[model samples]
Target: MAHVRRDKKKLLTRIRRIAGQVAALERAMETEADCSDVLIQIAATKGAMHALMMEVLAGHLSEHVVAGKTERGRAEEARTIMELLAKYAR
Candidate 1:
């Protein structure tokens, strides 16, 4: 989305951090780290991913749905957002 372009760097940084968390989780598994440690890493990674998703979702709502030029367009985007939330939300 065009709005993403405005915050591309910030989003990339969040993605990179999430990637690092995943790599750490992989390493923990490879080394047979304690289960608690592995679980903690998993939680951290999931939370980071959720936060990133929320940030982008907010942007989409603001820039695409709320700012849509037509009522129909807004309604369509809102429905898509609801579907995504239903599919992905914890």
Candidate 2:
């Protein structure tokens, strides 16, 4: 779950789109579409999933790494999450 928890509405919307993308991929396979077309859809789905992940990660950082930090521990958790987010973005 990559630590970010988004609002219900945003989560649901992203999930719905991912589900539709999955269905589309399946249908494309069933219809024997071009390999390129199927791959393109797969990439689109991946991009959507990544966007959702970023949203959730941001939320997690806000609530946990920032709000939960102490004066002495502030740098530690914030740095950890920033590193993780950078890695994920890459």
Candidate 3:
């Protein structure tokens, strides 16, 4: 989790932005915004979430998988990442 610690500020900033997007989306829904407007908000929120996931995934790959000293450990990490990716893709 050292890499997470190093990038904590950046990650937190992204999380905060995502939260704002979610709030906006909620407000749009509450106000009965136009369908197109609501869709745009939804897309924006989804993109923000994907971006955050990607950033964390990249960090995990670099810090945990690629940096692993043993082949078995790296393989296990890779399998875990693949599982996560499969779930996320769904």
* After superposition, candidate 2 runs with Cα above 4 Å error: 1-6, 69-90
Q: If ranked by lDDT, best first, what sequence of candidates would result?
A: 1, 3, 2
lDDT of 1 by residue, 1-90 (tens): 987999999999999999999999999999999999999999999999999999999999998899999999999999999999999955
lDDT string, candidate 3, 41-88, tens digits: 999999999999998999999988999889999999999999999999
TM-score per prediction, in order, is 0.97, 0.72, 0.97
RMSD of each: 0.8, 3.6, 0.6
Q: lDDT per residue, candidate 2, 1-90, as tens digits?
A: 334233787788889999999999999999999999999999999999898888877777677667774855667878878788788768
Off by over 4 Å in 3: none
In candidate 3, what residue range of length 10 has the lowest lDDT sum? 1-10
Residue 42 alpha-carbon offset, candidate 1, angstroms:
0.3
Candidates 2 and 3 compared: the better one by TM-score is 3
Q: Candidate 1: misplaced stretches above 4 Å? A: none
- Which pairs, if any, clash in model 3? none
Give lDDT per model, in order. 0.96, 0.81, 0.94
Maximum-lDDT candidate = 1
Looking at model 2, residue 32 earns an lDDT score of: 97
Which of 1 and 3 is the better model by lDDT? 1
Sort all candidates by TM-score, best to worst.
3, 1, 2
Q: How many clashing residue pairs appear in each of the predictions shown?
A: 0, 1, 0
